[model samples]
Target: MDRPALLAALRARVGRLERAGAAAALARSQAGVVHLSEDIDAHLPQGGLARAGLHEVLAAEPGAAAGFAAVILGRTGGPVLWIGPDPDAWPSGLVRYGLSPAELVLVRAPRPADGLWAMEEALRCAAVGGALLALSDIDLTAARRLQLAAEAGGALGLLLRPDTEEAGPSAALTRWRVDALAGSGGSAHSLGDPRWQLDLLRGRGSTPRSWTVAWRTTTDRLETEGGTLAAPTRNRRRA
Candidate 1:
């Protein structure tokens, strides 16, 4: 193999070894990192969300994936710019997930092509804390463009793609597939806080895994059941 290819392989091996220790992972998470729960953090090499990185989200159903994105934005604790074909953002609906409509800036593009353009431009703005781009189609080239822009501006960029969009190739730091599930509302008469089936399909320096988590409206936190199975606990805070 060439020298560069040999170095890349060595780096990948080192990353795997670093993520194998649970105790070391826990320490990194506690030291000013975003808490995604112990189980989830253990699987991530960084033990938390990568700052100023691009993440791609896909859903079996449309609205379900968007809800999960709201959870991420809430944790980001910054203003969000959503660029899509329509203004589907409902401030009241997003409150349960932690993002208030007041913190949102909606930009409606006439077409998917236009939305992609707007997404890159928005990521270049320093004032924009986070950005979500809803596009029906994006190739590897386009995806890399968005990624570079986000890295330059030091912001998080969420590429919201359709369920049919095959997860083939991309430059995103992480790729997630989110699906909503029905759950007990605590009481018989009402629906409970939104529950979702989250799949980490791909991430740099991490293994792919799945988990079920629910949004707790009262505290604006992601309630997980220890990891993959157990009962929900409300101790974790979103921020």
Candidate 2:
């Protein structure tokens, strides 16, 4: 096999082994998974973001990452818990993304350790439909703890970390990076709908992929702007 193909195969094998334990657990929780767009779900092992699994979202742009994550939680039928150092997410901003403020539970943890603790507790709470932790960094151990917590609680755990953090190995079912994209001109009176380039850096039994999409308020859905690709350029973040 070619050098690139060989390396890719080896990497995929390693990822599978690293996540082997959680695979069976997540498989059993497929009924609790929340489906995204059919196209995006097609590439995910659980057919969508498994509600009882942990996922990572790189904070390439804080707003873009939060917006994307919010879009995911909007699909859920229950409350969301957000734990982080910042408590600046006001209701008005999230409403447009289809996430209601009333459904959110915000907890501010000034210290990193405190934030992790809060996230772990929230993830393991069955009452929480989703838990989002905004962190600057995380290790494989911490990621695994949160992953297992999500499994136990039947809630989705989302880690929003800075893009500068090395995209190392993790226990997350999927890692994503969302970057704000230039708006496509349409409404002269508006700045155009929010657009983002989404990179699925890695997934369980799924090849890395990229999609450009816009959150259309009128349609209340994330529409793929130019469709999707099996793999984006190497310049983009990958794990």
Clashing pairs in 2: none
Residue range with the least summed lDDT across 10 consecutive positions in model 1? 230-239
Q: How does each model score on TM-score?
A: 0.77, 0.83
Q: Candidate 1, clashing residue pairs? A: none
List, residue by residue over 1-239, the lDDT tens digit for candidate 1. Answer: 44355346534533443355334333432343344556777777888766567888886667778888887766655567787889688878877777888668777776777687777866754445578998777888988998899777556789888766355777999888777778648666888778877777778987667788777777776776546633223332110
Flag regions of model 1 displaced more than 4 Å. Answer: 1-35, 186-188, 229-239
Residue 33's lDDT in candidate 2: 76
lDDT of 2 at 180: 89
TM-score, cand. 1: 0.77
Top TM-score: which candidate number? 2
1-239: candidate 2 lDDT, tens digit per residue? 44355346534533443354244334435557777777788878778777888999997888988999898877765567677888666668988888898778777777777778777866665555677898878888988988989878777889988887467888999889889887666566666789988989888888888898888877778888667787876586446
Clashes of 1: 0
